[model samples]
Target: MRNYWVRIALGALVIFTVGMVARALINRGIGGVRGVVEGSGPLSIPLAFIPFRLGGDKLGTLERVTFERTAPQSVSSVRLEVKLSDSLLARGLEGCRLAANLDSKDGHRRLSESTFWCAPAGSDTALVEYGQAVFRPGEVSVPLYLPQDLIDELQDLNFDGDSTPISEAEIDSLEASTELSVDSAPVLRARMGDSLRAEGMRRADSAKGVPSRMADSTRSR
Candidate 1:
């Protein structure tokens, strides 16, 4: 009887562990039901328990978050770290971290750093620092446009980068980086900083600066 009871308890423990693991995976997927709950409004996540693990190869994720109001307009700080995979049980989100310091009252969008990749091999790297951004609320969508010269300041960006009036394609790319909340602007606005750092702006620093068209669009809006 003692042996049988032990076996039953062990089995129950295993089943409970399995259920928790399954629930975490299902809810933590990006855009998966989990993401919607954790990554949405007010930045506060309410659930029974949030188990956080590490991902070192494929994708990393975090959800069901909460924020304490530090100031009137700012949420103080936000941090997200998780790992998912292009393939199941894939290695994990190696060397992955995302940080955002947003000031909605001031319309400032700052993305500290984003590094996603496999351990020992960085697939993608994006970093922003040393400056600030101004944002404007849009009707259909909230669009964040660079100060023109700032985009050009990014190391690799063409001072004349298809200066075609901030095309929709560019906007879409930025959106992928910045979402509706958590900065609420497209990423292109911030990635420009990465471009500047990557291109070693010091080498090709231009007095001519970014295109004038940049100003027209930003001001017009």
Candidate 2:
């Protein structure tokens, strides 16, 4: 019986190892940004083992983000691309979306309080496109995309005839009203979700030597 148990344990180990290696191979083809350096930073998001919708508590936000001016030969454009892992996506997602909070030197304040659907294919990994360029990398909050329904609620907030945008505090208050809480990570908030967006905008605003055609798209805001 002892020998049988040992064999079972060994078999489980082998299966686990093979699964890990297979996941790595599957992701090897996906290329991340080359010039910009990565760091283990405060950027994080709630995660889960099973479908987060099923009460699984887990999170993995930004592993790292930094600014790099020297572009590699392989890098033709300024679009920042980040790859998600296969194993993580396998757990299932309530929804895939992105948010940002950035301040541009040109007096551009970007805040995507609403969630934008980012993952269309539902593949093992998702390619999150900022659709913007970062010219100067700054401290930006990076968080997983908030649930789509939650974002809809934020978007539906009444402006009440005020032409100007709502304050960040109001945004925070709105999020607080939801009373949403996650066991692994703090409930998503506008300020935290907008970190990446703001950083990308700052980079785009400060970026130099970009093509003229691409320039308009990056600076449209």
lDDT per residue as tens, model 1, 92-145: 111123222222222223322232211222322333322221111111111122
**Cα lDDT, model 2, residue 12:** 18
Cα deviation in Å at residue 191, candidate 2? Answer: 22
Per-residue error (Å), model 1, residue 14: 37
- Number of backbone-clashing residue pairs for each candidate, in the order shown: 26, 18
Give the runs in model 2 whose Cα sits over 4 Å from its true position.
1-60, 67-106, 119-221
- Most accurate candidate by lDDT: 2
Model 2 has an lDDT value of 0.28
The whole-model lDDT of each prediction reads 0.27, 0.28
Tens digit of per-residue lDDT, candidate 2, span 48-147: 2211111112223222222122221111111222333332232122223333322222221222222123334443132333223111123222223323
